[model samples]
Target: MNATDRTLAGLLSAALSDDPSRPLVTYYDDATGERVELSVTTFDNWVAKTANLLQDELSAEPGDRLALLLPAHWQTAVWVLACASVGVVTDLTGDPSAADLVVSGPDTLDAARSCPGERVALSLRPLGGRFPQPPEGFTDYAVEVPGQGDRFVPYAPVDPDAPALALPDGSELTGAQAVERARQDAAARGLEPGSRLLSALPYDGWEGLSAGLLAPLAAGGSVVLAPRLERLDAASLEQRVENERVTHTAA
Candidate 1:
């Protein structure tokens, strides 16, 4: 990461500049036998569209709390960066009633209805498919995001010192702090530029966020996320490691 990169957006910009075509997130769902890989450029485009959806459609602003109820998936990673870009503070495992907005996946729609603000649902399907039937009181993220502009411009600049993440333990981290911690974790894990880290961690806390997303972004490396990892047999896991050319492991 660059000395001046204090926010997730800055870190992503640096990565895009370094290599736009390199794979940044390689996601695998062993239970479904599904795999999806997103290059830096593609990932940025998804982030841009989602950011636009948050800023323009949802009218989400800086410091607004968004309850993010999703699993360790590629689209979840997109939402993380999208919230950062628009200065929306993401709450992982937060109560829906306390949030200004709520994003839930197929399994959490009922719980997410407590939020009075704009609600969005993700199908979490391959290629970002929409729900077969749109849930009541919630907009489909995959349906809404595609029509948004490819570029995103926040209404106000994000402050590096402003709180960006609200943890399950009720702790918060500013944008700068999160970036710094990601870099620190990357170094501690021996992650370097061009390294490939395979992760089988849930996205409910900092450990998973760092290993599955931020650490790779901080180190200019890539991540191979294996969600529902327990379902993968030992032989399948080994084959995945070999196929993805994984240099590091975080389980």
Candidate 2:
């Protein structure tokens, strides 16, 4: 891969071509007893569909800003990459009024509805479920995303220099910057090809973004994201490390 091919989508495409069958994300939520695994091929497929959903159903243009109100789960990671795929700026916050679109999780339904523009809600349930009865005005993501086409070609090409991530403290990184930083962090974290990293970091800021999402992808490794980490007892956590063959960790 070229050093300058630093766009998030470009990096993901490279991963897909390099080793599509490799596992990419393994999610565990001991609190909810959720275990979800995704291979590179599977992840790419979901990203394509979600990108298509964003572009076709939500009209998420390249410059669109999306405030993501979700946890560190498998599908949330999908949304992050999906936003990057189509050049949507992802804000890791619950403040929807500041964004063009707000992706609210199960806990933020009421606050998310205050957004003036479009709204999408994810149940964050296992297998990505829709609300039992559906929300009043928001589109249920799990219900609608799967029906979208499996391919996505953005209406306009994404600029590598365009902003892609928004942190809680108002810091932001462009697509190229985020990718480059991830590469550097991956090296620093001793990640290598096929390394399995067990991480108990929340997807809140740079550290979380690096460990939980980007570093693994950047280094041709995979992440075992353990959300609600405190819920896992010492023995359970240790057992997970051995089970996943974890080579690196960030807790």
Candidate 3:
């Protein structure tokens, strides 16, 4: 990452510039036997679309708290970058009742209803499929995101010192701080450019965020996310590591 770029958005932009066609995130779901790989260009498109959805359609603004009630899935990673791009504060594993917007997975729909503002739901199906039947009071993310403009321009500039993430312990990390921490973690974990780090950590704390998403981005590497990794046998896990060309692991 460029030394002058102090935000996750900047890191993503740098990665896209460096190698747009390289794999950025590879997701595997052992339960469903599904694998999905997103190149830097494709992931950026998703982030741009989702950011536009938050800014134009949902009227989300800088510092607006968005409760992200999702797990360690590829879509969840997209939401994180989208929020960063829009300057919205992502509340990981947060309470829905206090948020201005809420994004939920299939298992968290009931909990997400407490939020009084906009609600979006992801089916967590392969290929970003929409829910078979739309959930009441929740916008289907798969339906809304596709039609959004491919390019995203924030209404205002994001402050590097402004809060970007709110952790479950009620702590906050500003954009610059998060980037710095990510870089530190990346170095500590021996991550290098083009390193393929496979992670099975849940997106609930700093460890997971650093290992699964931020560090890889900061280091200009790629991540292989294995959600529901416990379901995979030792042989299957080994095969996945070989197939993904994973150089490091954090489970």
Ranking of predictions according to lDDT: 3, 1, 2
Per residue, candidate 1 scores C-alpha lDDT tens digits across 156-210 of 8898889999999889999999999999999999999999999999999999999
Q: What are the runs in model 2 whose C-alpha is more than 4 Å off?
A: 1-4
Candidate 3 overall lDDT versus native: 0.94
State the C-alpha lDDT per candidate. 0.93, 0.88, 0.94
- Model 3, C-alpha of 209: deviation from truth (Å): 1.4
Where is model 3 more than 4 Å wrong at Cα?
A: 1-4
Query: What tens digits encode model 3's per-residue C-alpha lDDT throughout 93-158?
Result: 999999999999999999999999999999999999999999999999999999999998999988
Ten consecutive residues with minimal summed lDDT in candidate 3? 1-10
lDDT for model 1: 0.93
